[model samples]
Target: MISGLLLLVLVGSAMAQRDLSVDCGSDGWVTVHWRPGLGFSQTLDQSKALLGTCPPSSLMSEDTLLFRVLVRDCGFIQQVMEGRVTYSNMLIYARRPELPIITQLVKCDYDSPVGEESEFSAEEPDENREQETFNMEIMNPDFSGPAPSLRFGLGSSIPIRATVEPRSHRSLRIYMKSCEFATDADIRRATQVHPIIANAGCLMESKSGNSSFLPRRHSDEMRLYLEAFRFALGQKIFLHCDLEACVVRSLNVDRKACHYVPEKRRWTLLDEPSQSYACACCDSTCPRTGLMIDGVSVHKVLGPLVIVENEPESSGSPDSRASSAHGMSASRVWLLVFVVALALVTVMGVLVISYYLCFWRGGRLGYRPSRDLLTKY
Candidate 1:
């Protein structure tokens, strides 16, 4: 027995040594630190830290574990590093803006090589690289100032390029606002019309102060392209020309305001509104009948139309339906009260009967205790 107890104690002691700690700090920006193996740890901020410790002597089940930390918008613009710790390795990840921003890597003094190096050596800096400039006058400039203004269609596709150091990863983002509109009543009368203002094939390439516009084509494809272009132009006019950024691989067009009916069935275009047919049945069978905007037969019995009208002063709006609902709620409340009262009365009746049996009778049914028997007890 003593030997078994000793073995158990040794096993318990071995289990207590496994744990992990994750430390987090922020100066101008956020920094996360991971201590050598405990189990798992994550820190959103120094004040808010998450530390996980496993049971002692637990075998390493998984090598890598993913954790998420949320930071409410902090306006301080900088890259934040998140740290992770495992049994044999420590890892750090960084988060930056969605758009392209300058990133700098600060090497640690005690950094050691992790793997074998390749045979290729880094390239020397190019001294003969020359910059080019273009001087094309704006035809219909919108504004005349230090920065000249040039107009581009709402749906014009522009090419973007970026140069970064070799073996380095960089991201570029551009934001743009697009608008589209159509005024042709025939097109408007169609199932749905998406205006096109600029052809998608139109290409604009830009570099520092040197920009070039590709040749334009007015072919049949270009005519089809105008449909999309007109739509974008209409949306821009509707929004009053909101300025937007042009991000790489990020082209988003906002058309949240446009409302077009679903294309379930085609709508007929009517020439005369007076010639529309009326429902033959009365209020119950067919409540109303009207022509849809596209002149399709719309029977109100199939779907009711909701209308809001101003109330008159004379007819003081007494919501009889609301009052009826309140009455029903009050009836339910009274029913609950009656049920509770009946239950209370039932419990009191049972208690009185029990008291009478225990005190009035000498543990015998329909029998009363005599005075002499009571005196002897």
Candidate 2:
């Protein structure tokens, strides 16, 4: 019964959507729209979708894109379009954005180099370029400015801007590979193994700084917006990004990768540069996700990296098979007491009835003694 109730709640809590269109091609684009309350039409983009953008390469390989849009706005898009607009051969996902933000890890499609390798926004670059290495800087969420520390409560959206150095007057392309919630254990395990977990959720990709100065060596920066509401109080967050400098030998090459350096106490270039990661990093499974941590099995459904407090020791145990003695629960003990009291009451009532029938009503013992005494008198 409990399982059924849980299933119902899960289904009911699912995000609702108005499917504008069903089938979409890989190379095709999708136009998503939503009406939150009355007549407000919400404008959406590719970054809000689960699979991000499905390009020609993806559709060609997968045949068709199984697409669905959120029936409301998710508070990610800023533009407003009148009603919902439909495009030729494009998929649609429209929904209301009324769900609470939590530490949720949403599944996203894998990153691929599908689009043409050109300057972002179609501006041609000069032939003579001689910059070798570049740097990435996160411009948004400001990182407490000079303090170099960042702290935010739940339900806060983190907008990331990673700028490349040598400054390309044009824009630079940024590709986000993965984003996930992890603990110190998970991070440690992942570092030991090559290639991070591929199936992690909340993936996004976009271009940045297209309309900057020209004749510069650096490309445009990459911007990533992450909405964190369901994260644990102190859990670590990890982000991975790949920056493409240019298409070389039919490949998108990144001369310098970017990641947060722990030892330096700042986000800078190191031997192992990742897209982004929190200070308290881990790579192990959480105990509440039905995984055993430190030889303890946890059966509860806690969010990612959530700390379990006052947990039980062996919640369900069986040890009374051989022995006759078994501990009774509180309810069982109360039931036993009630049954014994009822049995005693029934026995007393039967005894009273027998006494009335034999001694009082039938006069079996009283009449003989009285007759002998009266005859003597």
Candidate 3:
């Protein structure tokens, strides 16, 4: 509906089969405009409930069931090989709960654009660079800066904010596809990696203790809470997240960052309310983006965050500390005396060795008599 790059969708009669209208919008969301009347009304396939899912916004369209889903949220299978990435997913209309009646398959290539120029480049494309209007930061609860040390106070939350400067009236809907913490700035060569967000914005619940996307305040910004971590000898830490923007009027909460909160015991939407239905795919394998959204998809970085182990705490009572200091000074004096004595011994030994060598060569000429021996008596 919102103007998009009319994707490979050819809406057939009764939704026989068609490519979804894919729009890589400036806001980052890969809006897939699906055709109507997929015949969910006609099918009594109870098993269909278990097969796949659609975004809450797309499915409940009065009865047509013309579905929409963050392709990565609805059982989309992704494959990468030979400098290409492919996403595959299907829709099922079963006869009974199990018997199949009709099935439709959809596939999207990240590199599959209308033009023949489907090349991959390390640098971002010019148009995508122009659309990027966002910033990633490490901040506190009140959104105050001077970021805290990574060692203390558990961990910190990162705010990735987007502001349309000329201030577009369009509601800015942001979705994070995935995020990873890497040791290297160049993601392609990162040695150590910890994926805190994956499966299209699903937090690594069990892996990262309290890492989750916090509820959003304004549509302009989103926050993520990373759990406390300890990695010593860390050179540089970088948090990289792939962000998408939807240039639409209403809130597109269906496909934003989601996490399962243990305290509340519920799945929460990162940008919207917690009563989530579209987030069901977050736990398992979410759908994959069928359309190439690189134009609007922006990967943000907040780093070299510098998460390191805490310093060793100092211990010792005041009186005992004074004693320790006194003892340390005494040890330093002893060490200095020992060093001086050893140096004199070394010099004396060297001179004696030289005299002995001379005496062996030229008898008494090499050695002068002691002072007592030199006495006239």
Candidate 4:
């Protein structure tokens, strides 16, 4: 989904309707540029990207052959999508101020650096600090930005990346204590919760499926991707997570996320492989984190995400879903018509045979002229 959205934001290829061409096939940051507009149609392809006169700040050059440099980086509209930020603008090209010939869609996708403020937008960085220097939030699969209220297919995996920013407390390591899908964001009542990670940090579902913590890159960051599921059919779910920033001194039993490794025949610590013995209690009861450096347990809520029962069979577009549904409806109509036609043909054949036997052949319905025993005399 991220990749697909990025495609529109960053035009990967150059599409031209006529002499004038708009292209964003640059190396990085997606620099969309335009060539000289000469011998172009007066009424341009409305979809063609057009850049008007170059701004004073933009790099402008005047060639002897009556041409001017046109470029822009800012004036575009800023839009936020699923997880990433997109900058979009449509430029109208017209010699006459009142007339618009060509229209060009110019844009670029803002990707967050590996582990930096990827949570923040390209234009604005939202630190989103809570509970005294501690922070917890959901990041997109790319770890690019915040993922809020996104839609997911039921069977697909949601890369739930939860990270802790223990500002001055670098010695603290983050752990996934517990997580669940709840109908309500509050999740106060136990009846409303469908547990995903239980018993401190043990992935209870891992014994049967692929819900486990990913290997940690930094002590402050932890990612747990989940095979998407819902609390109810066609209902939205919220991820209610409890995270702990335990003071990291040495690797031990209680401070880790564990999942059952079927082949290894035991439970395993996500970050520490050799310390699988520490996760032995995952099958039953596991102790919680002992020392808290910040004395704050992060309760992160991410979603209102839609978990759909079936995804569109088409390659991958929302429009394809509607088209696929219409296709199915058409096929069913044709099938009904065929059945009705077949039934009609069978009835007609039966009627024709009955008439032949009763009137002409007279086999079963033969009426013999009995001897005039009484009536003729």
Candidate 5:
């Protein structure tokens, strides 16, 4: 019995070691490590470490606990290798599928002590008593040129590419917000979100040919790719993007520039303000451009094109032609069966009729002693 128990324990340990899947629903930020020779380089869960999702117990607030890592170079590499590096990373936290409509009484019940009086009123304040203002600012930096119009084929799985040049900044990061409606207000609402579209890292000038800017510049020249699947198919999606140019500091320090505020239940930009060249980079003096970088130029319409297969000229519509072809194939099978049945019936009938006329009737026109000269018996 003890030996059996030991074997079971060993089996359980083996299975546990193989189960490397991440539980994002865990209570805290789960830190995962990946090495080159750990039998596997990286798992899907490890690769998605950048996706910062809050635990169930964590309040859905504007403030999120950010995780950062610092890596030190031990020695110079002796071999050269090629790989594609992703400059832009985004954690898409879509609003919960179903938001519970909690009444003020429910909130008060949760926050207040069991028998204590509340300082704040349980009733909601009148809307006419106070006016709230959301600063609709276009503080985001401008592109060097006009935003390009893009057309994508439906189900193609290709991304839209754009290019922008940042001035007086360490890096330029682009965040996209899309809405079905094309109204300016709807567009304004999209910019307040945290999903990033592209990030052009710090473009600092350096004399060395091996500077990171060279690779970034080359990549920007190549294209700023956006996930095309973000837009719904067969509709004109209004894309409003905000460019946060890291002018005073690098992106590594200003990682909180774009995030959702759980307390307010709204998206906000923290840590840094959007860049504006005309205002000397002052947030107070600068007028927010309603998240429009190039005025109307920043807005774009993406139409998902439908791809149709080429069909040969036929006597009917494409659908009809297909149906006719199918019908013809089915009829041909039936006709071939009918012909085979007729041939089989004909062969059987011939055999039966020949047997009756020759063998049963003795092959004689009149049954008179015929063939007497040829037969010996």
Candidate 6:
């Protein structure tokens, strides 16, 4: 009886050492250390961990816990190795009845964030009271994730939220506006909102949550009067943005340009503004010369070209008359050919049917009996 009691105490001591320890490293490495009996036990819970500060509450009937180690790096995590361990059931213990132990190593990768900063400036006219004033500020812009740094595509809208410091008694109104770029004979226009002024205060909160404003035509002349302030080209435009606002801010942008010919009355690239330039030549006039640049035309001399409609052609050259006649002749020729073909097909079909009936009598080329009956009568 005393020997049996000693055996029970030994078993109890073995059960008490059924714990595991694991060490994780930043270099995607994990090391595990455990006692042979409990670690190799096949009856352990595979999903439970028996190591570190929070160990599994209970072990398997065979004194083991199911534990797995995984590594994550470069946005990926994978299990390198796994297996079950067992004592005498799995391993032949020479003298010590300990289980066969196992350990695994793994490596993985995850993505890291990259940062950048930029600055921009612009000016405009005030919209509130119609004042020609401007404001400026320094902005440190940062972009993250999968966004491009320069030359954004069209249809891309960036959310903007900012706080302004006023320099005058008038409330600093923050807004956006449009600008115009014209050549000697062309007028290329674009619209964008610059900051405007309104009330003067330190913590001026501008809620840009639903403020989805985009550039429009004639926006160059009209500034986005944020109440009392305005921003235009050759004007001051900058701001100090709050951290919360910066995270959500984004920009929607598009660009287009086209070519212009003075002699041609056609205005091309009107639908595709990105590729076409703005022409200065009025629809009423042709042969008027002008300077074209960047899809915009600028007129050197202002004359009837600027006004007056329904101007008659002052010259009728032989090329112009011939071109008109050719267009008419082509239409006439096509119509005549279509009518003639239809008539010929109808006549040919009628003639073929008549000839077949007259030449080919009844079967076997023999005479019919209608005439014989008439002769007998």
The model with the greatest TM-score is: 3
Candidate 3 lDDT, tens digit per residue, 1-377? 22223224331124355334444443323444443333554633233332144432434334333444453455444444444545444443323322222334445556432223323322234553435476666654445553444332224333334333213444566666677878888888888887777767677743347556666776656766666565424466787878776543222222456787778565566654522433555554544434333325677887776544433111122343477679889999999999999999999999999888776655855577688877857
lDDT ranking of the models: 4, 3, 2, 5, 6, 1
Tens-digit lDDT track of model 1 for 1-377: 00100000011112233133322222111132332133345222211112111111222233322222211111111111222111111121111212111111111111221122211211232357331211112121211211111123333321211111212222222111122222332333334333211111111111111222222121000001110122323221221111121112101111000111124111111111121111011111211111011100110110011111222211122343356568889999999999999999999999999888887664677667699987986
User: 1 or 3, which is superior by lDDT?
Assistant: 3
CA lDDT of every candidate: 0.22, 0.28, 0.51, 0.54, 0.26, 0.25
TM-scores across all candidates? 0.16, 0.24, 0.47, 0.46, 0.24, 0.18
Which parts of model 6 have CA positions greater than 4 angstroms off? 1-321, 361-377
On the 0 to 100 scale, the lDDT of residue 169 in model 3 is: 45
Q: Which 10-residue window in model 3 sums to the lowest lDDT?
A: 311-320
Task: Give me the candidate number with maximum lDDT.
Answer: 4
Question: Which model, 3 or 6, shows the larger lDDT?
Answer: 3
Candidate 5 runs further than 4 Å off = 1-151, 168-233, 247-374
In the order shown, the candidates' Cα RMSDs to the true structure are 32.6, 23.2, 18.9, 23.0, 23.6, 28.6
Sort the predicted structures by TM-score, highest score first.
3, 4, 2, 5, 6, 1
lDDT of candidate 2 over 1-377, digit per residue (tens): 00100000111123553322232223323232222111235433322233222212222111122334331212111111132111211122222323221111111111221233212211223358544233333322432222122343343334444444434443333222233344433455543222321211112111111111111122344443343334344544443333333321111111222332235533322112322221111121111111111110111111122222221111111122212223346568889999999999999999999999987987855545567677887
* Model 4 TM-score, 2 decimals: 0.46
lDDT of 5 by residue, 314-376 (tens): 212344457768988999999999999999999999999999988887666666765876696
- Per-residue error at 71 for model 4, in Å? 67
Better of 2 and 4 by TM-score: 4
lDDT of 5 at 55: 14
Root-mean-square deviation of Cα positions for candidate 5 versus the true structure, in angstroms: 23.6
CA-RMSD of model 1: 32.6
TM-score of 2: 0.24
TM-score, cand. 6: 0.18
For candidate 6, write residues 1-377 as lDDT tens digits. 00100000011112343334444434433343433343342444333322221233344345444323322211111211122110000100111112212211112222221111111101122356333233222111221122122111122222222223333343332322122111122222214332211111111112321112223232121111121122232322223211100111111011111123334522222223331211111121111111110111111211011111221111122343477679889999999999999999999999888778877543437755687789886
Q: Count the backbone clashes (under 3 Å) in each candidate.
A: 32, 35, 11, 3, 13, 64
